[model samples]
Target: MITPMAIERTFVRTRKLATLLAGATLAASTTLVAGAAPASAAGPCGSSYSRVGVYAISRGDGTRTGTLEVYYSSSARKNCALTYGYGAYANTRSWKRVTISRADGSQEDTDANYYTYYAGPVYVSAPGACIDVAGTVPDWVTRELNNVHCG
Candidate 1:
């Protein structure tokens, strides 16, 4: 037999799990989506986001890599989250990118501040660094590249 308190706990847990699953699904779906404009190809996500810049790093092989940075600011302007990414490109010349999705497909909560980004690796890593790897882009430094973008 289940008591009311136990049932309530179960309901809460179930709701949390459902929310988690929904977030995961949204993120998975939006990953393949790309925005019209590209943010930064260089610099790590920081307080003063570059907003516009993408540095390139090439590997000897036919491959490339990049890093991206974005920012999120709370209402008080105190809490902030810096999101970054590192991915890889099979073709060095062409890029495999990740962009912000539209609100309809946003991964995170609409009210919560966040940034969407994608990156790739061009070379092997060396200690704290990866070959042909650029840093992140600062959110503060970007213009709307696409009508449907994540910020």
Candidate 2:
């Protein structure tokens, strides 16, 4: 006959195993979700642009819903911006927007519409001046950067 101490030890081991399994499952699911995006040959902005910045768009509860990405093309003296939906929002039609403006108030470009994946690739040729950028995703925070990326 098994003793009470033996049964208690077995129950403790079982509980530990269950906790480990739960942690491992959560990790694996997170990895899969993060890796699901298809690789792009020219990136989101294009072959000529290099990513310079990224800002997160989050819900009131701090759930990340999207990102605002900024890319720069030194050769063209231009900056491009895009708003990309994340996780459950990806590949779903939603209101998205991206805007870019020069600090001098000379040029402003905006792209806003219902998009499956992203908002834009809006560009502004700022050259040596600073630029402002903004992005929005439905039901998420609208993020903005002002007078940034000077040079």
Candidate 3:
């Protein structure tokens, strides 16, 4: 005793379930894609320095628009950092601050500007100590990340 109305309702429910499943799969895949990137993928200090850490800063729109990169030149026995902006902020006047601290209470801080795209391979004379980096991009669109250990 199946009615046409009953069949219609079943079909609608099946379609809704399928849609939900599809959305879930898409979201999961997006998460995987974002997480797949290695931290050092955007090294800015040339091939001589090995990228050790990266800190991302997001704007009010929740889009990542800037990055602070920490690099170590093993051959030179020094730690370095760089900052840059992306998207619409790129090539605009941007200000960034990077601080690298050593375990011995010594630190190097750089406040730099990008008239074009990026700033610094700012160096900190840290040797044989765990290093911490913190930075910010300050302007109409502001972002910051702190306490990143980049040994």
Candidate 4:
């Protein structure tokens, strides 16, 4: 499953057309290549750039848990985020009740949580508006799924 991190923050910045070149789309699609070229490859998103990152969080409430991270800009006009949930780990519970809180008041609360045991980072770029997350998806996302399916 895909996790979404919700952070809260405001910023303003120019939308630079940055390129993200990858090695092989089919091979390393889910894998994040380190120090990749600016326009090496496209991400698992519609936009040319990947902003939001998702991760799964282990909860103690029998119910599944997860987190989100919304990235902010300098001018308070641009923002992005990342998310992940428990389904990615195969928990079996819905992860919609989850939310990620950022330093800003902006929020990130979801009405659905299909992730329950599997989790990973879902990259997405926006039009500089939804950069306020509600919580954090934890660092384990990178540590756990870093090389699981990545080639």
Q: Pick the candidate with the highest lDDT.
A: 2
> Which regions of candidate 1 deviate over 4 angstroms?
35-151
Off by over 4 Å in 2: 1-40
Backbone-clash count (model 3): 0
State residue 148's C-alpha deviation in candidate 3, in Å.
4.6
Evaluated with TM-score, which candidate comes out highest?
A: 2
Write the number of the candidate with greater lDDT, choosing between 2 and 3: 2
TM-score each candidate. Answer: 0.23, 0.69, 0.56, 0.29
Compose the digit string of candidate 1's lDDT tens values, residues 19-125: 99999998877775554334644323333333333433333452324333233322222111222323432223222332333323332211112234433211111
Candidate closer to the true structure by lDDT (higher is better), 3 or 4: 3
- Can you write out model 2's per-residue Cα lDDT over 17-100, one digit (the tens) per residue? 999999999999999988876464476677778999999988878887889999998888899999998877778998888889
Instruction: Give the 10-residue window scoring lowest on summed lDDT in candidate 1.
Output: 122-131
lDDT of 2 at 83: 94
Report the lDDT tens digits of candidate 3 across residue range 1-151. Answer: 9999999999999999999999999999999998877665645665568878777767777887677788888777888887777666566776755656674547766656654566676777666566666555655444433444434
Candidate 3, 126: how far from true, in Å? 2.1
Candidate 4 lDDT (Cα, 0 to 1): 0.35
Q: Please give the distance, in angstroms, between residue 94's alpha carbon in candidate 1 and its true position after superposition.
A: 35
TM-score: model 2 vs. ground truth: 0.69
